[model samples]
Target: MTKYCRYHRNHGHTTEECKALEEKIEELVRAGHFRRFVRKDDNSFRSHHPPRSDHRCPPCDSRHGKRLNQPANHDPQPARTNVTPVDPPLRGIINTISGGFAGGGSTSSVRKRHLRHIQSINHITHSHHRRRMPPITFTDDDFQGLDHQQDDPMVITVEIENYAVKKVLIDQGSSVDILYWATYQKLQLSDTAMVPYNEPIYGFSGEKVSTCGYIDLHIIFRDGAQTKTIPIRFLIVDAPTSYNVLLGCPSLNTLGAVVSTPHLAMKFSSPSGDILTIYGNQRLARECYMASLHPQLPILQTNHIERPPSSEIT
Candidate 1:
């Protein structure tokens, strides 16, 4: 007698004895299909998976009422509001803008008001730009192709107006985005493209650097087929620097890019919620650093003088 299998509709074996049928059922169970048939406490067909931990931001100071470092069993006490509120003086109509607080009263009240304002702003921002942004994580695998032994600045290439621009330095220290005059000229943009900005920017050495003006350009950051285009206002400065452009905190914050020096890469989320990573060229970064250190000096020319050797000596 032959056993009949309902799954295979064959007489070779029963469904319980069929290896292929068993495998198919197991695969479906693992894929979360037929969940109603699965036993909750059955260890025989159970799978254990650890919970994922996604890091949002760095650990903030716990003194600011954050429960980051609080013990699991510790109970938080309510904030004391015993301080006498001091009413801030009213200001008259001022012609010029001056320093002032939006919230008046005691320091605690002011801080609470400020926090509320920040929270409301964040809520509005998130409501407008809500998306499933993949968390940016820098793991040991991100360092696979990088040279871990050397300290190199993140110098990567970007596309501006469909032109591939190189030697773009990612500088978190800089508050503003900068575009070198040389690079701007190479881009073949007209002078009229820039809006006249008279404000001079200071360098890292506190030297006042004059700017020609500023221009808003759409820059493309790409990782293979995935790309993010952002309109960045770049200040065109006529300064001698190895880097063609300096990407600063303004653009970084706008892009929400996380720069990892150890990995020598910058990662950010695209509009489609894909994580796009831009890796730095270590060789180009080193070359740029070396070029900045030893700038091209003018060649000294010696004027040839003809003299009678013996008569001139006498």
Candidate 2:
């Protein structure tokens, strides 16, 4: 019922059926089209079209083999990838280091040091408010003034100070010492007395939990080899952690212990010895800080509000 056009006149068909008929003819032609240039070399066919709009192999572009341009489904990440890949050389070195990793027997620390030194130099020279803290060197005098502590059984030696090493946690972030009831009941600590913190305590998972009671415990520690004991306030936290005791900043500060990333341990000065350095790690801190910082966000904090009154005397 339709008329034929010049394009399909050779096909002996009307324009309505020309499209189907033309497709068959062009498909036969496209194979020859492919053989013509594809065998020209091994890489691929060089038959590309000019910049006009209708630039495509008529048969190849038709619905027979052509597909619609559908978008791919991308996944949204909840957090970091679950796969904790092995750390690179830098991370490995930091990992293997235990007790203390004061310096290298180790990584290409020289080159690494040089790079860091250059970076530090550049930063210091360019920055307006750059100040470096000098290293701590404790002589035999500043600590000699304190009262001497007596010997005890449960104490272990880290350095000069004697710390009581019970089945407890030595959290350096707490002001009041913590003691779990189970640990207390086990140790038979006095004053099963209750002093409750109405506020909730959060764990690494950030779940709120209740706290039970507070107890006073004697802590013993060692230096070089000598052991001693010190009385400390112990608060009971009702959490499921194996950490029966939590030692906070106040407790650490009272004992004259200093925590540094370099040593990766806690150093405590014993009453019997010189300034003793204990090592602790910062892996949690590193991971937490990294998790808190979005890749697109700037690390520096900016304040536009007015400054507070100066505390320094004139």
Candidate 3:
């Protein structure tokens, strides 16, 4: 009697000798399931039949049945593309310009155009250098009523925010206008009206003080028939001072003013082609000077005087 194979169900062959079973084992090895048929004694599948020499891989159509020897599903190298590098038009123009200056085969029209462009640039630069401001001059009438004997600082009365403010000092040395905190409070301005100012101001005594804030006010300066209205930014500082407000270089330059200390008056050319003059308040200047000296005078007296006066009196 012929015994049949259990796996292939074919007669005349045992399960170990069946060719179909051998092919099934090779398929399982290619599919990564060869571990299931491995024996626990040797840790490997022991087949009595030899491996097929002409077996083809299912994935890559190669002669090797192992999956690792098969070719990859994707192409290893990327497809080549036709790409060309390009130069900018500005580069071409620059090359043309350099070639023209280097005495190359450049056209006369191109050379003439480049020369004209260069000449235009030189003409603009030359015109800027030639520009000049006319000299400023003053006449004898500019100092008509000025008295040098008064020897007062340039103090004037100006109208600010529709309020007549006195003790306004014209300080050419200062770069900004300043409104004393006390004077600003006297104007009855609301606290919300001031804008924040972070800049510090230095005084003549080399002392630095932080500003409280600033406010914009319409300042009206009158000189006889001439009057100029300007918007002034005043930095408010909480410091004791003789002057209520200080008119610095910013306001003076805006009005095109010229200050003469010897004359004790400020003169400026009005828009109406007339020279307007504002004179200093001699009496008010003296008063402020005395007030400024009062605080220091007491300190000086206390420091210098001694009890020798009582001994001299005895």
Candidate 4:
């Protein structure tokens, strides 16, 4: 069945569902054209309908300039109970807007602009108390376990899915986290679990490194009893690398970790709000660098020295 809009004098949507008509009605109401239709009390019309207490507009994605569909199970923002009474001008305009507007029916650029204008006028901002993280400062004692003589990268071990993954290099300069093909195979992760990533990453010499895919894995950063587990999306690359995984800026920043090369340690806040420092294996770091130079050489494995307690530090 074909529907026609008499307002537009065209086929497709009905006259009642016509967006242009609704916009025109809203504009006329705002201009005091429909003074008789608007009730003397703006709250009277709203009291009966009570704008569905449960309904909420999905958060706007600034990048896309559109509303993203959220999952059914997704937690919604707390419904604002202390909503201020709408101004007469806005209430009059709202009275003319079709029921569709309230239920996300019409999403024209004009509608968006009008809604934004209304939101700006009646926006309620809720203030939240932010939890302050303890100050992370590296002292000379942070270097007690390391050999500062060698210019080695920050290489350490992090647990992945409960497995102690060794030869993980913490590169603060790297933008993306990387998981080598050899390590991926060792993890016994199904290839189907990998989400396809097409963008090629460039190396120092402008060489393109082909990516297999990317996977979000929970990696455990531990310093004795203090542990921080964060999900990291590691780009799987079929490249020759001595390191099993490379921890980059994305994960480091998320974990609030600070890397000090001179100190040969990575420090991040623990769940208990105390600073937990993970000391880099200086011996393993030099070995990994040497292995990178000699790809033919077998990857050397070593015992991961568990970081000593903070009390033991001088």
RMSD of candidates 1 onward, in order: 26.1, 24.2, 30.3, 25.5
- Worst 10 contiguous positions by lDDT, candidate 1: 299-308
Query: Cα lDDT of all candidates, in order?
Result: 0.69, 0.40, 0.63, 0.68
The collision pairs in model 3 are none
lDDT of 3 at 300: 19
185-211 per-residue lDDT for model 2 (tens digits): 544445535554444444444455555
List of clashing residue pairs for candidate 4 = none
Q: 171-222 in candidate 4: lDDT tens per residue?
A: 7667678887778877778989898876666665556677888898998888
Q: What is the TM-score of each candidate against the true structure?
A: 0.54, 0.34, 0.50, 0.54
Clashes of 2: 29
* Candidate 4, superposed: residue stretches over 4 Å from native: 1-132, 302-314
Query: Model 1: residues >4 Å from true position, as ranges?
Result: 1-133, 144-146, 297-314
Candidate 1 local lDDT, residue 264: 92
lDDT of 1 by residue, 8-83 (tens): 5545334455555555555667666667888867645533333223342224466785534334453333223333
Best-first order by lDDT: 1, 4, 3, 2
Evaluated at residue 226, the lDDT of candidate 3 is 71
Model 4 TM-score is 0.54
Candidate 3, TM-score vs. the true structure? 0.50
lDDT, model 2: 0.40
